[model samples]
Target: MRLRVHTLLFWPHLVAGLLAGLIIGVMSFTGLALAFEHPILERADRETQQVAPPSPGTPRLPVDELIARVRAARPEAQPSAVTEYPDPTRAVTVSTGRTGGVYVNPYTGEVWDWGASGWRAFFHLMEDWHRWLGAQGDNRPVGKAITGASNALFFFLAVTGLYLWWPRKWTWRTLRPSIWFRRGLKGKARDWNWHNVTGFWLLPVLIVLTATGMVISYKGVSDLVFRLAGETPPTAGGPPPGPPIHVPVPPPGSAPLPLEALFVQARKQLPAWENITLRLSGGGAPRGNAPQAGPRPGGNEGKAEARKEGLAPSTFAIRETGGWPLFAATQVFVDPYTAQVLRKDAFADLPAGNRTRRWLRFLHTGEALGLTGQFVAALGCLGGLFLVWTGFCLSWRRFFPAKPGLVSSGDASTSE
Candidate 1:
C-alpha cells in the first residue's frame, strides 16, 4: 500500500514539476535577484548621491527651500512630496509623482538629477518578470493568471515533495543518502540525490514563500485568509473611508502653513520618527477653494460639511525606530493651512485582517523579518533553482536513457 501510494504521488509530482519547472525557475531566479533589492539600492544611492555638510552641526535647508530649488531646476516638475531623513548626510528626496523624483542636497539646495541606477532598473525588470512574467499592457492579466496558477502548483509540489522525501524506513542507512550529498554519484544517481536533498531541506521556506505568493495573487485566497481570521475582507477599490473628522478652516487669503510648520507638527506627533514623508494635498495643485474662517466643529454635520468643501489634508507618513513588523508606517493627515492634525492612523489601529494582509505581503519577499529573513528567502530561491535543474535532468534521463555502448559529449556532461 505504501509503495502504491508513493507511486501515485511520485508520478503527479514528476509531471507537475515538468510542466511548471520553467516558470518556477524564472520566478526563483528573479526572486533571488530581488531579495536584497532594498540594501543594494541603498548602497547604490549612497555611492552616487551621498552628500557632505560644509561644517558640523550645519542645519539642512528647509523643506520649502528644497522644493523651490527642485522646481527652479526643473520648471516643468510639480513637487508633490518631500522625504526627509534624520541623517544629515542623506539627501532630501522631493518627489514629483509616483516613482518620479530628484535627490536634493539639503545643505546647498542643489537639486541632483539622479536617474534610476542600473541596479534599480534591473530590479524593476526582475519585479516585472516575477509578478507577471514580463507581460505588459492588456496582457498583464493573462500573465498574472499563468504565474498565479503556477504558484499554486508550486505549493502543491512543496507539500508532496516533503512527504515523498521522507524515508519510509527510518534509519541512518536509509536516510543518510537522501539527507546529504554523496560523492562518486553520476547521471541519475547525482540528479536524484540533489533533487531529494534540496527539496527536503528547503521545503519549509519554499512553502512559506509560495503560500504567501498565492495570497497576494488571488483575491479569493486573500479573502479566505481574512475569513479564517474572523475579520471581514477589505473591500476592493481602497480601504473603507474613515469616519469624518473636523478640519479646521483658515481665513480667506491666508497663505497655507509653511512646510516648516507641518514638519514641526509631524515631529511632535512622532518624536521617535526616523524618516517622515510629507505628501502635498492635490498633488501640490493650487488651492482654489480656500476655506473661509469658521468655528471648530459643533457637530457631525459640521464636520461632514468641512470635508465636503475641499478642505483636503496633506499627509505625513512617518517611519519610526523599532517599529514592529518593520513595514508599518504611521499616517498623519493635517489640514493644509491650519496644521491641525485631522487624523492619525497608527499600525495598532489596523484591523486584524489588514494587519495579516500586510504581514503576508512583506513575508512573500521576506522583508517582514528584516535582512536575515531576506537572506534565508534568497537561499530558498537558490535551492529551488537547483531542484529545477536536477528534476529536469532526472526526467530527461528517464525518457531518453543511454543505449548500449553509446556515449556523447552531451551525455558525458549530463552524467557528470
Candidate 2:
C-alpha cells in the first residue's frame, strides 16, 4: 500500500513537471529578460533622458503650445497624451498612439523623435512575447488560452513539487541535502541534490509568481477572487470601455486650464507623488469615424451621434507614493477642456481583490522589493530553468533504466 501510494503521486508529478516545464522554461527565460526591461529601455533612451535644463529664466512651454507643435510635426499621428517629468532636464513625452511618441524639451519645444526607435520597438516586441508568446497583438484568444492554461499547470507543478521535496524522515540529516548544495557529489546524486535544494528555497516565490500569472490570464478566476474579496471586478458586465476616449477640444480663445494647474491639483491629493503622465484625447480626425470631408466612397452618410459618442476622454496616471512605482499608480480622469478633475482611483481605494490584482505585476516581476526583488525574481527564473533540466535528467533516468549489460553501471550512473 505504501509503495502504491508513493507511485501514484510520483508518476503524475513527474509527468506534469515535464510537460509544464517546456512552456514554463520559455516563459521563465523571457521573464528573466523582462525583469530589467524598464531600466534597459531607460538606458536605451539615454539621449532623451539627458536633455539639458531650460536656459536660465526660460519658462516652460505651455501645454497647448506643445500640443500645437506636436500636431504640426505629425499631422496624421494625433497627440493622445503627454508625460511630464519632475526633473527639468528631462523632456515631456507626447504619445500619438501605441507605435509613436516624441520627447520634447518643455523649456524650448525641441523635439526628439522616439517614435520609431529600434530599442523601444524591440522591448515592445519583447513585452508581447513575454505576455503571450508574441500572440499577434495583446489578448488574442488563441495566445491568451495557451498562456493561461500553461500558467495554471505551472502552479500545479510547483505545489506538487513542494510535497515531493519534503523529507520523509524529517531529520536534520535528511534535511541538509535538500536545503543546501552538496560538494564532491557526482552524476544523478548531484542533479537530484541541486533540483531538491533549489526547489526547497524557491518554492514559495514560484507559487506567488505562477498564481498571480493565473489571475492575470483568466477572467473567471479573477472575478472569483474579486467576489471573495467582497467587491465586483472593475469590468463586471463587459470589458472596460476601450481606453478613455480623448476629451474633445475646448472652444477657441477659451484658454483651457494650464497643465501646471492640473499637476498641482494631483500633487495636493497625494503629497509624495513623484511623476505623472497625462493623456489627452486627440483633436485631429478620430480614427474609425466616417470621413470628415464627405460621405464614404460608398456614399453612405454615417450616423452622426455614433461618431460623436466614439471620442475618448483625457486621463492622467499618477505615480503614488508607498506603492509599486511601475504598477500601482493611480488613474485620474479629467475634462480635457475645463481640466476639471473627474475622478481618482488610488491604490488604497481599490477593492481588496483589485488591490491584490494590482500587486500581481510587481510580484511576478519581483519589482515589489525594488532592485533586490527584481534580482531575486530573476534568480527564480534561472532556478526554474535549472529545475527543468535536472528534472528531465532525473525523470528520464528513472523511467528508462539502461538495459542490464547494454550500458555499464558506472557509465549509467555518470550519465544520470
Candidate 3:
C-alpha cells in the first residue's frame, strides 16, 4: 500500500514539474530579484531624493510651499499627494499618481521629477513578470490566472515532496544522502541528491511563500483567510466597511484650511511619526457633510461624489517608528475647512483579520519580519530555482534511463 501510494504521488509530481517547471523558475527568479527591491531603489534614488542643506540650522520649507513649487515647475502635473520625511536631507515627494511623482528639496523649494533609473525600471519589470508573467492591459488577468494555478501546484509539490522525501527506515545512513548533498556525485546522482536536499531544507519557507502567494492571487483563498479568522472578508480591491465619519463641510466659496494646518494636526496626532503623507481631494469648497468609511480615503467614486457635493477633506497617512508589521499606518481624515479630525484609523485598532491580511501581504515579500526575513525569503526563491532544475533533470533521466553500459559508476545508485 505504501509503495502504491508513493507511485501515485510520484508520477503526478514528476508530470507537474515537467509541465510547469519553466514558469515556476521564472516566478522564483523574479521573486528573488524583488526581495531587496525597497533597499535597492532607496539607495539608487538617494542622490535624487536626498539634498544637502545650504547651511547649518537651515529650516525646511512648509509643505504647502514645497507643493506650490512643484506645481509652479510642472503646471501640467496635478499633485494628488505629498509625502514629508522627518529627515531634513530627504526631499519631499509630491505624487501625481501611483509610481508617478516629483521630489522637491525641502530647504530650497526646488522641484525635480523622479528621473529614469535603470534599477527602478529593472525592478518594475521583475514585478511585472512575477505577478502577471509580463502581461499587459487586458491580458494581465490571463497571465495572473496562469501564475496562480502554478502557485497552487507549487504548494502541492512542496507538500507531497515532503512525504516522498521522508525515510521509511529511521537511520542516519538512510537519510543522510537526501538530507545533505553528497560530494563526487555525477549526472543523475548529482541531480537527485540536489533535488532531495534542497527540497527538504526549503520545504517550510517554500510552503510559506506559496501559501501567502495563493492568498494574494485568488479571491477565494483570501476570503477563506478572513472566514477562518471569524471575520467578514473585504470586497475585492477594497477594505471592509468601518464606522462612518461625519465630516462637516464648509459653505461654498469658503476657503479650505491650508495644507500647513493639516500637517501640524497630523504631527500632533502621531508625535513619533517618521513620515506623513497628505492626500489632496482636489475638490473646491465645501457644500454638505459627507460620511467617509474605511481606513483609506478618496477613491475615484468618493472623489467624484465629493466634487459633486462640493465637499473636500484632507486625508493624512502617517507612519511611525517601531510600528508592528512594518507597513501599517495611521489614517486621519480632517474637514478641509474646519481642520477638525473627522476620523483616525490606527493600525492597532484594526480587526484581527485585517491585521493578519496585512502580515500575509508583507510576508509574501518577506518584509513583515524585516531584513532577516527578506534574506530567508530570497534564499528560498534561490532554492526553488535549483529544485526546478534538478527536478527536470531527474525527470528526464527517469523517462530515458541509461541502457546497456552507458551509465556512469556514480549513476548506478540513482534508481528510486
Model 1 global lDDT (CA atoms, 0 to 1): 0.76
Alpha-carbon TM-score of each model against the true structure: 0.86, 0.80, 0.91
Q: Is candidate 1 or candidate 2 better by TM-score?
A: 1
Clashes of each: 0, 6, 0
Error of 1 at 27 (Å): 0.6
Error of 2 at 165 (Å): 1.1
lDDT of each: 0.76, 0.66, 0.79
Alpha-carbon runs more than 4 Å astray in model 1 = 54-59, 237-255, 285-309, 404-416
Error of 2 at 369 (Å): 2.4
lDDT of 2 by residue, 266-303 (tens): 55666666566665545632122212111111111122
Q: Residue 273 of candidate 2: its Cα lDDT? A: 65
Q: What is the lDDT of residue 372 in candidate 3?
A: 91
lDDT of model 3, residue 44 = 75
Q: Candidate 1 residues 287-314, lDDT tens each?
A: 2121111100111112344557656565
**lDDT (Cα, tens digit) per residue for candidate 3, span 175-293:** 89899999999989999999999999999999999999999998888888789889887675544555455556667678777778777887888878888876654431222222121
Rank the candidate models, highest TM-score first.
3, 1, 2
Give the RMSD in angstroms, all C-alphas superposed, for model 1.
6.2
